[model samples]
Every structure is written in C-alpha cells, then in structure tokens.
Target: MVEIAAWLRARQAEGTLRELVDLDHLGHGRVRLADTEGPALLDFSSNDYLALSEHPALIAAATEALQRYGTGAGAARLMSGNFPVHQELERAVAALKGQEAALLFGSGYSANVGIIAALMGRDDVIFTDRLNHASIYDGCRLAGAGIARFRHNDLNHLEELLASQPVKGTRLIVVESVYSMDGDRAPLHELVALKERYGCLLMVDEAHATGVFGANGGGVIEEAGVASGVDLAMGTFGKALGSYGAYVAASRRMIDFLVNRARSFIFSTALPPAVAAASLAAVQLIQQEPGLRQELHQRVALFKGYLRQAGFAGDLGPSQIIPLRLGSSATAVAAAERLRAHGLFVPAVRPPTVPEGTARLRLSITRHLGEAELAAAAAALVACCLR
Candidate 1:
C-alpha cells in the first residue's frame, strides 16, 4: 500500500495523475462540463470521426432492436445469448472487410488480445510493432510465446528481427492499419511482400481506419489493394461507426477456430441486440454514404492546412488523429487548459498514454464539427501550443 501511494505521488509530481471529467454532449461537436452549466466547448477529443453515433439511422435501428429484444443478451454467446442481430452484424462486418467470415467480441481490445492468444502459442514467435496497442502485448503475454517487437512502422527493423529469429512454429506479424495515436498509415504493400517472403500470417488492426478510408470504408487494407494478402483483418464499431464492439474478419476456418478457442469470446456475454443492430446499421450507412468519409477528409485537410499556415509542423498526418508533442506533462496539460479557455476542449494526453517526453494533446477530426468549428479549433491550437 505504501509503494502504491509512492507511485501515485510520483505521478502527481510529474503532473500525470489522471482524473475523469463528466461531460454533457450538446451534439454537433459541442460539449459542456457537467454539474455546473458550463459553456459549450468545441469537442476535438472524440474518436467519432464520422459522427454517426447520433445519426437518425443508427438511433432508429437501435431503438427498434431495443423494443424487440429488451436490454441484454442474458447469457454468454456460446450459451443462449446469441441473437440474430449478432449474425447479421458479423455478416455485414465480413462483407465490409472482404473476408469469408467474421466473429464479434465485446470491444476492440478484447478482440485483439483474444485473436492473438487463440492463434499463437508456446512454440510460436510473433513479430509485432513496438508501438502496437497494449492489448496486443497483453495477448502476447497470455499466449506465452516468443515475442519480437520491432520499431514502429520500420519494415527494415521488422525484417531484421524476423530474419534473426530461427523458423519454428506458426509465425505471425501484427500491426495497426492506422496507428491510433500517430495516425500514420502502414505500408500494406511492402508488409504483404514481406509476409509472403517470411511465410508469416499478417494481421492488420483497422480500428482507426475502418470507417474513414477506402471507397467503401474497408480501411487501409482495401485502400492499398492488399486485402487478400492479409491473413486477419481486425476492427471495431465503436470508433467511426459510432457503436460498440469489435470483430475479426478472416477465412471461415479461422473464425470457426476462434469460435471454439478464443477464451474472451467464450467467457463474455454477447453484446446487446440493440448495439449489434446499431452497428449493422452503421456499417450499411458508411457503405452507402461515401460522402461522409470524403467530408471527414476535407475536414482533416482544412484543419491541417490551418496548422500549416500557422507554422506549426510537429506531427500532422493525413488521417483524422493529430498530435502536438509538448515534451512535458505539465506543458501538455497547460496547452489543453489554454485551448479549453478558448472554448475548445482538447484533452491533454500524457504518459503513460504516450512516451515520457512525448506528452501532447490528441486532436481527432470529426464530421460533427463544421467549418467554423474547425477554423476556431485551429486558431486555438496555434494560440495555445504554437506561440
């Protein structure tokens, strides 16, 4: 207990102690701090890139399912909890990812960890990106396999590790299609070639890219024309889809194997029928409305252009996520406060969310915000962090 307290004190000294803030959503990219009737602040910290969470289509689907199916699934999926909406959503996900089959999990983190644990085992060696999500690392630990972590997005480094490790068991390589924090995309073509050369299974976590890329929102894999080369396509409905749950799209055999072997899926209750239905609606909506993705990119371009014009060239990527590293936790927190002072509520992302010296504010471009809001956010960022 003393050690725990000391650790917390250390975090406090570093200005990294975390706390949750209650917020009231005001729609159209505005939020107010709850309990005090605070002024509406431009919400630039949400992951709802396409802002479909509050769409009428999604809401109506969820409402219908709720009225028909009640509140919960009542049991684990392997038992009696599975609903028709589950299968329907899985089919939609499989089609979206261009795979023969798919299986749903409670969340993106669970899907990732469960997928890794079920596939690679004691004799296997998995090569993963150094900066891959924590769930991937947890999955590696659960699998009890030989783990090789290469530098983030460095194919040469990954190849070096792959070549050095002697061939043994089922070799797998995992990476995110679009990094959650950095927002940079993976080199799918090169990774596919390397996978072919090494005879390794390749998995791409398309959580961030799923609803924001490709003509039909199939993510970076489809955008790069390497969907067939990827062995497993993992993604979530919670982000741009604006619903809850995650899924993995793969061959029929692989998904069947997960159905039988993935412990997370086997042990957890199925997602509520309404959430699954909402997710299905979100998927169909994204496919039918390509304008949503296009409009989001236009917002990205507009915001990034503003930053460029303001002469702040730290870390601006093509995707919706952007970071402005401030090197100190206190500095990042101060920046967030300054932005909030200007009626923009971008959160300060400090360690351990980022590296020790890479603390910054993560700004997510969403369709909820209009051109006026985007311009105001850009101006605030420049005033808060740049100058």
Candidate 2:
C-alpha cells in the first residue's frame, strides 16, 4: 500500500495525475451534474452530434435486438458469438460506405488500435498528424512502427519529413478527416496527391465526420470523393450514429487480414447484438433522412454566425466542434464554471486532450438544437468570452 501510494503521489507531484470528476449531478449534453452545482445546465458538450442518443427509432432497434439475441454476443465473432446482427451490420456498413467489405470492432478506440497494429508493424513507417486522435497514436505505437509526426495539417512538413527518409518501408500516412479538438478539417485532396506521389497507403479516422458529412453520410472520405482512394476508413457508431461500436471500411483483403491479425478483434467480445441492430438502424436513418444533415449544417452555420456577429473571441472553425480557446487550462476551467453557473454546460478541455496553452471549451452543435437554443447558447458563450 505504501509503495502504490508513493507511485500515485509521484504522478500528482509532477502535475500529470488526474482525478475523475463526479457526474452524478450532470444533465445531458455539455452540462454535467456536479455535486456542487445547482440547476440543470444547457448541454453543449456531448458527442451525440445527431441527437440520436435518445431517438425512438434507435432505441426501438436496440430493444428489439436485445429481445431477439439477448444482451451480449457471449463470444468473439470468429467464435460462438457471430450473430446474424453482426453480419447484417457489416454488410450494411460496407454498402453505406461504398466499400468492398467492412469489419466491426467493440469501439472506434479498439478499431483504430486493432486495425493499424494488425496491418503495419516494426518494418513500417507511419506518418501521422500531430492532432490525430490518441487512438491513432496508440495504434501506431502498438504496431512498433517508426513514427514521424508532421505539423498539424501541414502537407509541406509531411512531405519534407517523408523526403528526408531515404527508405520508406510500408509507408502509412494517418490523419483524422475532422480533428476532434480544433474542429478543423484535413486537406484530403492534398493528402491524396501526396499519397499518390509517394506511393503510400492512407488511413483516415472519420469518427467525427460520420453522419455529419457526405451526400449519404459516409464521412469525409466519401464527402471528398476519396472513398476508393483511401486504403482504410474507420468510424465510430458512438457519435452521430448514437450507438456503441466501431468499424473499418476497406477492401475485402484488408478486412480478412484484420480478422486474422488484429489481436483486439480476436480477443474482445463482439459488440452486443442490440447495439449492432441499433447501429444498422442508425445507418438506414442517416441515408433516408438527408434533412438531418441539412439541419445540422444550418446549426453549424448559425453557431458560427452568432460568434461572428457577437465578435466572440475564440477559434471557431468550419466543423460542428467549436473550440472556445481560453489559452490557459485554469482560465478554461474557470470559464466553463462561469458558463455552468449561468445554466450552460461546457467542459474545459485541458492538456493531453489538447496541446499545452490551448486548453479550451469544445462546444459541439447538433440539429436537435433549435434556433432559439443555438442563439441562447451562443449568447452565453459570448458573454463568457467577454468576461
């Protein structure tokens, strides 16, 4: 006990330790129910971008699946738990993304780790964006690939780093289509050109872009018309899909390779049948309801407009996830508290999730929020900025 306590104390002394905040008092969206807090705050923080978290259709699908197949898969897909729901989801996701095949994982976090590590290894060279999701970074590390990080979204830096290397062994370039933190997008066209020039494979994490972009809601790869160009595209059902699962859309060969090689996929239990059913329903809904995307786009535009009109000071980008940069973690935390005090919920994203000195409030907008809600949240944000 003394030894463990000493180790924990060391981390706290170095300012790298974290203590999870109690969410018992939190409400939905960005507002959490803290024990010390009063009143329900307006939520602007949830990753449920489509507001499908509580959608009746999704809920019904999940309930049906649970009734039909029970709550758990009971085994890995390759083993006894290969349910019909999983097969249906794989096929549905493949068709939705216009890919040859799709493989399901427990979560986007595991999908990225499992797929990347399985595909690339010690001999591979993985070029990554600095702002890519931590799952990507971990995947690269797990693969034991030599990693080279370029500046965030800087193709020139990427090219320069690639050029400096005399031998490119199994080159893999990784990036997020829409960075989760800054809410900015990747230059897919330029990335395609670079990949073509270097003869490298590209892996895109569309976790944030799924259900938010594309004519059919496939994500940035489809939105940019690079679905066929990218070697692998991964996304999460947890976000806009309003469920819990992750998938990799790729060629049949790649899918098969992951099936045999990805340790996480092999060892972990398959996603619950209910979640898979709900995800399949979510996929169908995304395609059938183009209005959802349209409305979300309108909300994004409206939020940005409100910021511009109010002259709110922050890095408000094109994506739905807007970063209200406060520059310091302490200040960001304080501002979040201030917003919460006004019945507005916004979490302060501190270091590790974001780079140092760039701690901010990550505000995500969705179509579920009406114009009045948007305006009110924006006004509150602006007031917080002013303070």
Candidate 3:
C-alpha cells in the first residue's frame, strides 16, 4: 500500500495523474462543472454527435422500460438476465448494419476485448493500427497473440508486415473506422483488399463513425459499400446514437460463436432493460431522422471553415471530430483553461490518450449547436491558440 501511494504521488508530481470532475449536463451542448455555478458553457468535448441522448423518444422509451422491467439485470445473459428488450435491440442493430446477426456487449471496450480474446490465441498473429483504441490493444495483449502495429492509416506498411511474415495459424487485422483522437478515417477499402489477398480476417471498429455516416447510419462500412468484405464490424451505441452499450454486427454463425465463447459477454450481467430500450429507440430515430445527420455535417463544415479562416492549420478529415494540437501537456491544459474562461468546454487530451508532445484539444461537433454558438467556440479556440 505504501509503494502504491508513493507511485501515485510520483505520477501526480509528473502531471500525469487523472481525477474525475463532476459536470452537470444542461441540455443543448451546455454543461456546468462542479466548481462553477451560474453559467453553462458550450461543450465541444461530447461524443453525442446527434444530440439524441436527451431526445424525447429515447427518454420516453427508457421511462417505459424502467417501469416495466425494474432496474437491474439480476444475472448474466447466460443465466436469467436476458430480456425481451435485449433481443429486440440486437435485432434492430443487425438490421441497421446490414448484418445477418448482432450481439450486444456491455460497452465498446468489452466488445473489443471480448471479441479479440474469443477469436485469437497464442499461436495467432494480430495486426493492428498504431492508433486503434486502447481496448483493441488490451484485447490483443490478453489474447497473448503475436501483435504487430502498423503506422497509423498506413496500408503500405501493413502489407509489408504481412509479406515479411510467414503464414500463422490465424491472422487477424484490426482497425477503427474513425480514430477517436485524430478523427481521421482508416482506409477500409484497401484494408479489405489486403485481407482478401492474405486470406486473413478483418475487424473494423466503427465506434466513432456509427450513427454519423451512411444513408441509414450504418457507418463507414456501409458508406464505403464494403460491408460484405469485412468479417467483423463492431460499433457502440453510446456515441452518435446517443445511448449506452456496444455491439458486434456479423454473420449468424459469428454471433452464435461469440455468444458461447466471449468471456466478457458470457460473464457480465446484461444491460439494464431501460438502457436497451433507450438504445433501441435511438437506433430507430437515427434511421428515421436523416435531418439530424445532415445538420451535424453542416455544423462540422461551418466550424472547420471558421477555424480555417481563423488561421487554424490542422486537418480534421471528413469526420465531425477536430483536434486542436497544443504540443505539450501543460500547454494543452492551459489552453483548455483559456477556452473555459471564454465559456467554452473543451478537453485537453495529453500523453497516453495521444502521443507524447502531441497533446491536443479534441472538439466533437454536434447538431445541438447552431451557427452562433459554433462561431463563439471557434473564436475562443483561436484566441486560446494565439495567446
């Protein structure tokens, strides 16, 4: 215990320790932190891209479910915890993603780690993008597979690694559709082609892209017209869909396999009925309401244009996520403070979340904010950078 205390103290001294701060979510892209009382700021750090978390339909669904099914899932899914809402949500998700079946998980992290661990083993070889979510890396490590990381979004490097290495028992390639920190998309088409050439399984995590892309919010896989090419497509309902839980959309056989083999899914209690109901509502709304997706894209364009006009140089790619690079942890924190002072709430992402010396403010655009709020946020960010 003393050694643990000393290590924690050392981390705090190095400015690497993290502590959670309470925040009051006032609707429409506004939040007030516990330290402050009166004014709520325009938040650019949220993953609620469509602002559906507080939608009336989702709220109503959750309320109805809570009244009907009580609070907790008493046991794991393999036991007596599986409810009607759970199956309904899975069916809806599978249809949305154009998959034959879908399996729900407690969270995106659980889905990633569970899927990888269930499929790969010590003899298998896993190739992952260097910038994939930490959950994917954790899964690889836990599986005890031979892991190789390719340069971020570099298909050439991936192919080189594949060519240099001999055929292993099972080769799995993992990547994210849109990187959470950088907001850049992976080359899914190229990756699919490579997977075909090498006869390896491909997995694409669409956590950041789902509910924001495609005609029906099926995500990048559907948008690219390569849904059939990829083997496993994983996504989360907590981001653009503005709900909780995660899922892996795959063929019927794959879903069945995961139901039996994935330890995380097998051991964890099922999501509460209310959460499943709310997520299902969110998914239905995302399909029915194309206007929300359109508005989000327009806002992203407007915000990016404003930043460019203000002399911002970083590219945010085609996604709604934008990063304001600040170089050092101290500078990023200071910049966040400046933004907060101007009634803007942006998080400063430091080392481990981002690469060393590339600490940045990750700004996520949502449809809740209109042009005026976006202008203010852009100006505040520009001022912080200039200062």
| TM-score, every prediction | 0.98, 0.94, 0.97
User: What tens digits encode model 2's per-residue C-alpha lDDT throughout 278-334?
Assistant: 999999999999888888899889888887777775567878998878787778877
lDDT by residue (268-349, candidate 3, tens digit) is 9999999999999998998999888999999999999988787777675789998878788888888888888899888988
- Tens digit per residue, CA lDDT, model 1, 219-325: 99888888899999999999999999999999999999999999999999999999999999999999999999999999899989888777777669779999887
lDDT of each: 0.91, 0.86, 0.90
Candidate 2: stretches off by over 4 Å: 1-17, 24-37, 313-315
For model 3 the local lDDT of residue 166 reads 78
- Backbone clashes for every candidate come to 0, 6, 0
Clash count for candidate 3 is 0
Minimum summed lDDT over a 10-residue window in model 1 is located at 309-318
Q: After superposition, how far is residue 293 of candidate 3 from its true place, in Å?
A: 0.2
Candidate 2 lDDT trough over 10 residues, lowest sum: 23-32
